[model samples]
Target: MQEPPLRELRCDVAVIGAGTAGMAAYRAAREAGARAVLIEAGPGGSTCARVGCMPSKLLITAAKAAHDARRAGEFGVATGPIRVDGVATLQRVRRERDRFVAGVLSEFEKFPNEDRVNGRARFVARDILVLEDRDTRIAFGAAVIAAGSSPAVPELLAGLGDRVLTTDTLFEIPDLPRSLAVIGGGPVGIEIAQAMARLGVAVTLLDGGHALAGLRDPDLVARANALFAAEMTLHFGTKVERAESAGDGIRLTWAGKDGAGGSGVFDRVLAAAGRPPSLRGLGLEEAGLSLDEKGGPCFDPRTLMGEGAPIFVAGDAAASRPVLHEAARQGRIAGRNAAALVRSGPTGIATPAPWVNLAMVFTDPGTAAVGETYDPERAAERVVGAVDFSRQGRARIMDRAAGALRIYADRAGCLTGAEMLCPEAEHLGHLLAMAIQDGQTAQDLRDRPFYHPTVEEGLVTALTRIIDGLDAR
Candidate 1:
């Protein structure tokens, strides 16, 4: 019997992936009067709602409540002993997670049915895509690649056969393990390790180097290490060479940079190494797009456009900024530019103004970095403003005094970047980002009102140090 012919469809723009960036790109293209079709493979909810941010935060919130209750004795307000129910805690996490995913699905419902394609897509030509499941061919004037990302497992941890988990699979477990070995020291690893540790799990965090959560300042890195070390086992400068299934647990053997080696066995192993762009089987090379060292599409960061093709890569697929807000911004930019490519043919459009850079790790005393974070290699070129939060009035009053803040300024006295490890650093990160975005000087921020008896007042102390440094120069 002869097979049926493939169905053919056409659109002004074809967006692959239905995550944050893909959704934003589709909306922008449609708003620009372009026919845009969104192609997604099975999973519909974005990574943030599904696994990355929301669920993790829900878990962390539960962990924080338990931690605070255990420490109620410091405030001399103790009702009774605190006990954590692991099963109940995770049940609530999954329950709240489903609610958040439902909201994202509602947004997916808003898109027109004709614009949605349910299948995996691969580029067969520069302007064409073939949906393998539907046996449909789509021709587009321009395309946006927003095909999200997945957790990557290192070769050393492969074939362990059981109990090896990544962020993608970690949250779905029925209950917390008695002990966990976190195999990466990046943001995800650090956050999960701390949260699990606080919830009565023995978490051991291992890293090949001393870097903690992308902190660039030596002082801050040391401070953060000291803080985290008090709670869990930290094995920096240690490289894991072997992992194997040992009865009901996994055995990990490692060698340290100091010529020391150690081995341990844990009930579970979490490979929080990193998340690479999920572009497998998309046939990027066939689309005439080049790959970088990390296997991401080679595209201009400013326009999100591939160097030699009429294709734009955004979100986690672009492998630029992996956060949700950055993904949304890239989606809008890529969508607008893709539509312009369709409407006005070839000559590029003006790029949107860049957004301020802000990132945070949701640890107890959170870590935040805004703009160009401090780098010791360029120490002489910038002035540093420092504050010890342990001495801040609000921190001492609240009995949560265990963090530091560092703000950076150029020689011209303009506020440039900041890195901090303090309670509510997320808010401080946003405030600093706005000042830097507005091109404000250290003196300008100093003139602004700083309310008394608040964590924000710590900013005044740091700014005064910057002014003093400027005067001395």
Candidate 2:
């Protein structure tokens, strides 16, 4: 029997993986008047809604309320003993998560039917993608890959069965664990550790690396340890040795701090270790793409363009900026560029404005970092205006102020970046980002009026210190 002819169609760009970045790219490409088709590995809503940012944050908010209610005595509210129904809390989280997931699905529903392709896509040619399930071939002018990422489970922890969890499955539980071993020091690990702990779980946070939250700033890392340690036992510089099933749980063995050895059996083990790009089975080599050391398609971080290929890689797959906002921004940027590359010829690509990149961790006394930082090696060239919130007015009133606000600038007093573990730290970093984006100096931020006794007042104090140091120098 002769092989059936391959089904073929043409489009401006074939967008693979319908996550945050992929959806954004699909819409942007269409609005740019380019015919683009989007292929998703699964249903729409993506990780953020289904499991990550939204659901996790809902649980965090519940945990925060529970913790705060227990501490009502500090404010002389005279509330009696408090209690939390963990199952009910989880149900609420699921309820809200379903709503968020539905919202994202609704956005995808508005897409043109011809543009949405549901199947696994792999490149069979330089510019050709074949839907693995139905043998539908799409020959496109260009392509955008935003396939997203998966939790990086360490080799030792891989075969531990259902007891091992990631952010992807952490919320599936009806009740919080009695004891949890969180195996990472990244944002997900730290945030979830604190959340579970506050919700009445005994959490032991372990990190293979020395720094927490991937922060290398010695001072900030120290502050995070001091704060987060109060809630859970945190071990750094630890290497996992083994794992095995233990009475409906998992027993984890590791070399503890200072090369000491220890082991523990936990009700649950969460591997918030890292998020490596999910590029398996994509047949990237067939698409004429080279894989980098990080297992991502080697693409220009700024342009999102594959080296010498008519492809733009965005979102977690690009491994440039994994945050949702950054992913969406990358999607739009790559989408517009891909459309122009196919519709009007190659005109290159544009990157985001300088010094606009930022990151945030939503924990109690949350932390945020804006601009280029987390380095102490180049501290000499930078001035740090640090304000300890231990004595800050609003923090004292709220009984939640126990971190530092460190703002950085050059000798010229320009606001380059800021890192802080404080109340509403996310908002402070964003406000400072505006100044940095607008080319405002530290003095410029200081001149802006701040309401009295607000957490932002601490920012003013730090900004004043920066301006003062500039004058002294």
Candidate 3:
């Protein structure tokens, strides 16, 4: 069964990139009765291991400890002065991050196929990929673009070099900044802003909207904004007018909501803006793959298949949802479907069913939303269920409650979504998200047993309210 070395490296599937989605796709494709060639030009470890989820969470975990120690007094638990070792903390983050990455790399090395192609990949024909530098050609029956994305910095903010930081490079810095100004006050920005501020960095968050972390629910937005306003200097409805080097620091000028301008000289300016789909040098047109208005591969959302082509788009490369979990789902589904296509079959999925949208911002009083965000147009038809954590017994016991939760439901009583600015919202968010994903109704959610004296109790209270609203209608 051995083949000649000097021929087309053809396979049932060819997967691009080696990030979270790419790896998942590769594994799933293997299980789906296909051999795959995973192509990457750089280290093929999970992106989350290197620069994303895991590392950021590690940094936040350290910040949370330092933060919690400082606020221990509210619970009559007196603690000594807290001093965070920024150098040591960063060392731990990198060490753990590297360990996670190493594990992924090791797993990759053990992959049975060992059909990895190292070098730039470009489409020379509809189903033909050429490794330009290596002069290797691969004709895959089905190809997947799990190519990952990178943090997007505006062209206007380019050339700042070391003065500006992105999430991808933020953890690389050896030391924390004395002062920081965060651009694009979204989830990533707010998380880093608050975590650093808690770790003792003076922080200023300049966001596009009046809301903190883009809360669509007006009431939740106001509450979350008020919470963050007390900690960091906030300039909402503002845009960065100028960013320039000022001596050893960076000077930023922003135009505020009132048309008034504000300026600050900071030790660093971090951009947690957004991720652009990685499409550079891909030569997708050579594969007969067309691009959508979003500048991504035009693919069927359900099967991730390119329009009448053998290419399936997955993960950040497609820029759909842009969350790790969503990317994972895309990769698995796309991997299975791509293999099926290679077998001359359809995936049996026509229209893509939307997953429950779950977004979380890790801050002191975390911000989270699942599924539907509040829209004024549909506000009247939806039933609202709410609970203020500030009044919850468990929250009062912990002395850390300072936010609210609002759950929305359809007229048929199915739990649609929730927006919350609450303590331990990350946990609360997952629970609500799972409920929505499982198609649980208000009564069904209420039927779930609740233990006394816990955050789950708070959710129960909210569910009861929704049930009442359902009964009234």
Candidate 4:
């Protein structure tokens, strides 16, 4: 059978972004027997699979290797000067990213019910979308907004031009900076700072607020700070007064704690301050959707629906904190729930579940958390226990003693949250997420047999400490 022409094309579900969340939703919709289509504004690639997560992790891997080589002297192995070919390394990173994205695109092409449209999509009506390239309009029974975010660039520093780069553009620079100043201490900023410092860049990390504010645990912050202090210069609770063009670099003036001022010259400056969801050009308002106070689409969390019927929001486009994993999870639920509502009615399937077990991964020493941290005043009084990775034998063997594991539980012993800082923290994060999501107690994990002499043993030890402390209490 021959497919209909592009002009007459329509789908059961239309997803407006082809990033992680959009791809997940497209796949889910196909699995649920809906004809699905994905639209991407990016240049046939995704931020995560391209310049965002994948390239950043590649840089981190090279940095880690260099760091380990420098420490090889501890094992009585003599080494000469360490060299990093930044340009060549970046080329290799791009090649790897291209290959990965190609593989993903190939797999997506295998879906019989799914189609990929390469262009920007804007809402033409409640059920209609207009593609940018041709005069093509698509109508669908349901639509998902998964458009992800782009780096936020301050207008004041726009004059720096190529000298100042956002996360998306920084990786494309031809040469590595001899001295780099990162203007934000969030995950992207700190991760890039440490990775560059390890690669022999004189790196400085500046944050307007206390660094890592999302991390509520002071001990985890202290441990991360110690590692960063050894690797790079850190300026916290500071604001950039101005940035001026210099001979070959740029000069930055900043004010620090209690009106203290300082100046620095840097070869390059990366603005990793944050990202705002890509909401423009979507004609959201034209479709009757109103922006929330934070300037995102107002959504009903229960239905993932926008102001009007049949239009749903998901991923970064929705009024939710942006994270790749969370976006994908929400996209799956939203896609499924959207299909159910359109197919069998609102009661066909339960409402999309609220997000939980959101995990964040920072490459250096890594970190992962689920549920909520225990704050005496902020959180209902609960039982909390934290154990240092220095006490874990596996961490000792790995020579990574700078880590922490924490668990939070209620009076009934049901686990509420777990956080870990160690090698494979991302992997361990999922395990902890399961415990929190399933309402399992710390004792339940402690009693479960784990493989001996592995990183997982740290979890067992941490859980045991929680059990012992509870017994003593």
Candidate 5:
């Protein structure tokens, strides 16, 4: 059976953006027996596969290899004069990044040609979208805006030409810069700054705020900040006031909050400030949908319905939770509810319980915050148990002993949240997330089997402290 031509067509649901959330919504809508069309603008690939997570991790892996080799002597293994070939290192990153993107493209191929449109979509009316590139108008019964985000380059760095880089442009560089100034204290900036520093680049990280990687606990933040400062120069509560062309490089002048200021010349300046939702020029107002302060759709987070209209928003466009898994969940919910609105009209749908909140930073001693993280307002009701991995048995065995873990519980010992700056914190974070979601107590987690002389033993030690704290109360 042949589908109708694109000159004039109506879809039960029209999904904008071909990234992670958009793709999921399109497939989900079809599975719900709705006629859906997936729209994209030119080049198609997820931010993670193309530039964000995959490529950054590749670079970090190479840096870790170099760092480990340099420290092998402490483990009684001699690795003499470890050298990193910057060109070869980045070439491999690009090579592997292409393969990951190819995998995402393969998923795109599964959708039929008639169901995919290649153009930027803008809403002309509540039920109508115009593809600006081809002048094609599509009428949709319901819609999902999963359009992702873009790097927010600071106004100060705009005129520096190619000397400036963002995560989107960082991987494409042919070689590592001799000196780098990373202008952000967020995850992307911290991860890339440390990676470049470890890979023999002189890195200076500048942030206007004092927080490091979103850790609320001052102790953990201090620990992580000290660990990162040991490798790269960090300036917090400071802003870059000026940038200009220098002889073969760029010069940046920065001012501290306390009236202190300095200047430096660097081969490149990375604008890791932030990634705002890519919502400009989408004509969202024309669709009768209001936007939030962040320029994202004002919608119900659970149903993803837009302000009582027949529209939905997911992924970065929602500007709520930008994580990939969260985006995929929102996309699924939006698609299903859109189909339901078309078929049965907005009733009898059971919204799932809220998801567990988890976040991780892939730095040397990884950092993670899971579930109900530390809050000063709730401090009186919470008991915190902490363990320093510096003394943990397995940490000493592996010579990777440099971080701490803290678990939080209420007076009754029910696990509430956990934060860590520890080696292999990713695994520990996941374990804690599951326990918190299941309403497990500190005593319950302590009873769980922990293999001897492993990083996980540190978790057991922390759980025991929580139980002890509970008993004391």
Candidate 6:
């Protein structure tokens, strides 16, 4: 039998991966008068909108609600034993996730300048791509590799059977296990362990390094540790040697902080050991593109163009540390630059603004920070401001007094970084990130009026402290 003919199509920009970044880039390209085509690996949506961020957050909220209900008596509310229907809660989360994904798909369908293709895409050349749908082949023009990363499952524990689950497959679990051993101390592992523990599952979180190492604030890390300690067992400085299936559970052999070998058995083993960018079989080498040491496509920082101007990379596939917000920002920039390249022919600079702000959202007491952490060696003088949540009226009222807001600036008052571990830390962190990215000083945040009695009001108070300390000096 003869092979099917390749379907040829032309567009000003071709965005591969329909995740947050791909969608943003597609829309931006269309707005810039470029006909865009969006290609996705799975379906039309992404794990972020479907199972990753949205569903996981919903499950976390449900878990938190169940936990609060059990403690209602302490808040002067008479309540019986807290009950949680894990299956029903999961169903609701999936439903909402589906709706959100469908809404995004609907928006893509409505765009006249954007074409959505469902298939696995590989490079035919630098600028050309061949998308495979079973036996059909479709080609495109300029390509954007937004192919995001997947849950990193270590090779040592790969042979473990059904008991082993990654973040992508955790939501599909038939029922909540009696005990869960979460391997990895990063955001995904911590969040999953905490969520499951709150849902009444006995959880043990093991991380090779200290937990929340990226937070860079000892006090914030301690606060998170204390909060997590109330529910789950956290084993820091623990390395997983291997995993084997036991009778009804899985046995994990690990090295403890003292370098002693220890064993743990759990009903299920969740591998939350971060992610590796999805770059396999994408023909990157055929297109003369190479990945960095961090497993992301190598690209010029100024242009974000890898190998050639016709091929661009963004999102998780391009970034060393792929955060959703950063991916979207890079995607928009890449899309605009790609369109500009196609329109104006050869250009030196693709986009003027590069991705600068990176934010991470943790459920409940989340955190956000931008720019570099204060380094004594790199600074002539450093100014640090901090205010405990216990002093914040809203935090006290909300009964969440574990976190704080801290800001770091230079002697000249340029915002270097800010960390908020409050109830609304995630949102408040964005404000700080914007300020720092915009080169705003502590006075800018101090002068901004926050809503009365809100968690964000703590920002103003924290900045006031920084200003006062400066004046006193």
Per-model TM-score versus the true fold = 0.98, 0.97, 0.95, 0.92, 0.97, 0.92
Which runs of model 2 end up more than 4 angstroms from their true locations?
Answer: 1-5, 351-355
| Model 3 regions lying over 4 Å from their true place | 1-7, 347-352
Q: Mind giving the per-residue lDDT tens digits that candidate 4 earns over 250-333?
A: 899999877887889999999988878888888877667777786578778766777665777877676465677777777887
Worst 10 residues of 6 by lDDT: 133-142
Look at candidate 6 and tell me the lDDT of residue 255: 88
Backbone clashes per model, in order? 0, 0, 0, 0, 0, 0
Judge candidate 5 against the unseen true structure and give its global Cα lDDT, from 0 to 1: 0.89
User: Ranking under lDDT, best-scoring first?
Assistant: 1, 5, 2, 3, 4, 6
Candidate lDDT (C-alpha), each:
0.91, 0.86, 0.85, 0.78, 0.89, 0.76
Better of 1 and 5 by TM-score: 1
lDDT of prediction 3? 0.85
User: Where is the poorest 10-residue window by lDDT in model 5?
Assistant: 345-354
Model 4 poorest 10 in a row by lDDT: 373-382
Per-candidate RMSD, Å: 1.2, 1.6, 3.0, 3.6, 2.7, 2.5
Angstrom error of the Cα, residue 341, model 5: value is 1.4
- Candidate 6, clashing residue pairs? none
lDDT of 5 by residue, 1-473 (tens): 97545577699999999998999899889999999999998477888889888999999999999999999999789988988899999999999999999999889988999999999999989999988754588999999998899999988787788899999899999999999999998888999999999999999999998877777788888888898999999999898999999987899999999999899999999999888888888888899897777656788777889984689998888888888888888888888888878878778234777788999889989989998887889999999999998899998898888989989999999999998989999999999999999999999989999998799999988998888887887
* Tens-digit lDDT track of model 2 for 1-473: 97778777789989998889999898888888899999987866887898789998998999899899989888888778777898999999999999999998888888889888888999887898998874588999999999988888877777787688888888888787899999988889999999999989999988888777656567878888988889999888897889988998889899965869789999999999778777898888888887777556788877788976799998888876688998898889889889988887866556555348788889988888888675677778887798998899998888987888888998888878887788888899899888888989888889999999798999888988888888888
Which runs of model 6 end up more than 4 angstroms from their true locations?
111-114, 133-141, 374-380
- Clashes in model 4: which pairs? none
